[model samples]
Target: MTKTRIMIALVVLLAGLKSNGQEALFGGQEIVSPEINKDKSVTFRLLAPAADSVFITGDFLPTTKMKTPMGEMDAPGKKLLSKNGEGLWTYTTEPLASELYNYSFIVDGMTVRDPNNPFVIRDVSSLTNIFIIGGGKADNYKVNDVPHGTVAKRWYDSPGLGMDRRITIYTPPGYEDSKEEYPVLYLLHGAGGDEEAWMDLGRTSQIIDNLIAEGKAQPMIIAMPNGNVTQDAAPGMGSDGFYKPVFMAPKTMDGTYEANFMDIIKFVENNYRVKANKENRAIAGLSMGGFHSFHISRYYPNTFDYVGLFSAAIMPREDATGEVYNNINETLEQQYKNGLELYYIAIGKTDFLYKANQDLKKQLDEIGMPYEYVETDGGHIWRNWRIYLTDFAPKLFK
Candidate 1:
């Protein structure tokens, strides 16, 4: 098991596997599934000969009558994939709008990915193959010839949580050459999400780069941190391979996440060259992360001027306090009176948490809280979250 012996053994094993054709295993098959065509339409193919049936699932399809948000849309309720003589099942989608989409193959009722496509992203919420439809608003997600930003997987010590945790940071294109301080955006992930959630599925870096390049958004640093309270770090960095002290899961009944959040702020301010003030700070989150934003901005009204919530999981008026945000409508009024810049809330009309958002809106309106509300077509999926980021990032520090 010495280092050299292990390497040689691995090389020998890999060579033996490739010796049959010598190149097939290394280069992959000649077929490419989930091919994005120049016309914006996409072709998906799977070589699942043993599968009795196959179906394709992704954001490209409408979200109607789709049992679960992750379920592939098949009108008349299901899309029966077509089988070919080569034991390949195929499905081609109509021209799709430009955006990042998640998809997967359903083979005989089991979920699988396109063997031919290597680009895949996963989180607690969903796992699927991702493809980009180039055009329109999606241009922000596409990789253009713009000056790109740098993304770092950074770790900071949290005394409050008594552990080391990770956060993904994105510095805009000119950050390295310039010593000027930049604004900070504390982007949080939802339940079952780690620091990598936004970095992976949300396409945070690409969107920020495109926005800054187009002069739509300021050159700012985005810090995406793990929002789980009970878990000191994300899955791979944790002692249990996931959040533990099982009761500490942020989503669990115990309420402790918001209490320890200052460690994150302090970590950023101390380590990064950021303008640590309300005018130069923004905070946003999706789902559970949204709930965090609503409270964090409310509790510490002077902290972030810009707040965004995408498909937020807000509590009803009654349960909004005690375990959650400090139960005080007066605090909310104070938040508005304290020079809050942008209190933006966005949700899909079809989202399961739509009613919660409605209640939050009602509370905000009753309190005369000046905030912006955006409603898109889909549910609590990454597409809407990405759209929220695309729009919200540009509106910051203006």
Candidate 2:
């Protein structure tokens, strides 16, 4: 080859190598000159792996709803470059929104973490890169000098599950000051969640603090527990055919969890100045927690007066089967007459459990059970759950 030809070939090879190079651990792909256009269009380029398809899944796109037909991430707009032999790929697309969004890349049926972005967030499954399009409400999450609840990490022995577990409890402000008894709310978490799920991911304490300070919610003790009933049911049970942590199932029952939860309640009442009565106690949760709240409050009617279900997994009477059929009616009847004071059920419009929660409302109506049903924006996510707790707390123990 001539000198000019050789120089051109070398430059081309170097560019190819640069594009196909292995990305750093914290940097997966780059969105070259990501910008919001004058036409209200946001555009960016994605550098991906070779021989792979890249789909941009984020909150801005309606096609990204969870568990829907169009939810699967597919290649966006056009392919910027073919996957080189070195396993590198790149693409670009223009989305409609400029707001901050949470997204991920689905490469060959596996969700790969974003390497280019330093901000990482975790759901039940894996961590993904977080991107902010337009600036958001950062002041909302900042911890102010407001009176905050004290979080206690306590350990308890569970005879039901045959294991010792740890739980986190948040004592509301002035819990130690007044000798007067206070009410308690037991907040349960969903599958693949732990005791810290509410405090860490849901930010339940902050929501409660803000609501109570604003006089929108009453000050109450929030007891968050590890809701798993079996050894295999705890968080991090992947690769066991159960991709997500299993919810309440008959096959996984251990008698000790409910008893242990009660023990915690009793302990709180005895150790602290709590009301310690059914009228002052409440139980609520999301997903698996919702199922637990429904089942536990139903079975132990004398324990809790207020019950809230956020994106509950329990189906309606028409769709009930086996164990659900046997207990739902009885549970509804008990909740209607004497067991519960206020039964609250709320689910997001886009949540997968929306239809199920709606069916549950219908079942409650058919059985003459009284309840407050609410549907809101967002899905079965922390944003909704946090808002659920914020809205649900003021109505308790009033």
Candidate 3:
């Protein structure tokens, strides 16, 4: 063939390629990675040219049954993926409830973030992509136009813990200027969490701000302290780093937390302009934190008038021995006599700790302790905790 004819044919082919919208490699048309449908269903897509299998995991999907510190349990949701001829993998979820969910992609057995989704959150260990299904309960998870609070990472001297520890503080709107002393909530984190837990995964600021704006909650200071008794901070940055394994910290924490408990209270009381009164002080935690809140409030019965326990790690059959129960019941009786305002206990009906909470309630009933019990829908996940906080905070200092 002549050179001129070949060149003309190549030009025609190039023009056809450009006009046909045929991409060079694998991408051509606009691909929306995660498209939230009007019906609240979510469609996720990923482009992988060389992948054998792809799977997606999130709270929106049920995970395999696995053993936890509480006991052996199975998760709630699960999802699989399908591939198309264009090397694009896709999966669509059924209509999920209105809530905040974190998800990740597993491409050929290698876990990865959603390359197409830019919104991601860093939990204790790894980064997970996140999406919000906006509606009823989920609305609290978002940042609204209402006045927001400030979350500060501050370090304080914990002579009780024998080291300087870090804590996250959230001062509500108008706190800096308001000469009025505000009520304080001593919020604590669960196991494997840090001072950043409530502020990060729990959506502390967003919830508090939105509630305060809507008049659902009074403006109060929330002090979230790390609850790892053995460790100083989170997994890292502590005297006991991640290298040091802490299993069932609730069972193993002899008296370090109790011994150092007053130190944290002192730190918060002295640093913040909180009203130093029993009615103005509240203590609450989830899971291991719930365990801590249960004990700490009892240890100093008259200290905190308001107590909240979300999925508390209460072991009545084991931890609540005869002697312990006798002492705790005595304190419980004293707190009741001293006019305890609110003794709130909350846990998901399906939580692994559900049986434990029930046992604790039985003991409470036997001791004639009057407390409020809230049973939610889901298990021991953050959804319940966040909702518990949203519900519990409004009832504070009222």
lDDT of each: 0.79, 0.65, 0.81
RMSD of each: 5.4, 8.3, 5.9
What does the lDDT read for residue 43 in candidate 2? 52
Q: Report the candidate with higher TM-score, 2 versus 3.
A: 3
TM-scores for every candidate against the unseen true structure: 0.86, 0.68, 0.86
lDDT of 1 by residue, 1-398 (tens): 79999999998978776553224465435567778888888888777677889987776765555453323322222356799986778888888877877788888898887777888897673457887777687778877999999999888888877788778889999889988899999998877787888988888998999999889999999998888755656665766674332212534322456767788889888887899898999999998788788787877767888999998878644334444455658778887888888989999877888888999889888988888999998777788899999999989998
Give the lDDT of residue 346 in candidate 2. 91
Stretches of model 2 off by over 4 angstroms after superposition: 1-56, 65-101, 105-119, 129-142, 174-180, 232-260, 316-327
Candidate 3 Cα misplacement greater than 4 A, ranges: 1-31, 62-64, 122-126, 236-252, 316-326
Worst 10 residues of 3 by lDDT: 316-325
The candidate with the higher lDDT, 1 or 3, is 3
The sequence of per-residue lDDT tens digits that candidate 2 reaches over residues 1-398 is: 89999999988876765675444432433343244566645454445444356555555555432242212222212123345554545434454543335556566656655555555665555565555443333222335558887888776665545666667788888877776777889999876676767876676776677777778777888888777655432354211334553333332223345445666676567667788888999999987788778777876766888999988867443323334335657766876678567899998887777777888788888988889888887676665676677778889888
Per model, state how many residue pairs clash: 0, 11, 5
What tens-digit string does per-residue lDDT give for candidate 3 at 1-398?
A: 99999999998887776665425532344567678999999999877768999888888886567786658654644466899998888999999889999888888888898776878876546678888999878899899999988788777888866788888899999887778788899998877677878987899999999999999999999988877655566666666655643444553334457546888878888988989889899999988788778888887778998999999988744544423335777887777777788989998877888999999899889878889999988787888899999999999999
Q: Candidate 1, which ten residues in sequence have the lowest lDDT sum? A: 69-78
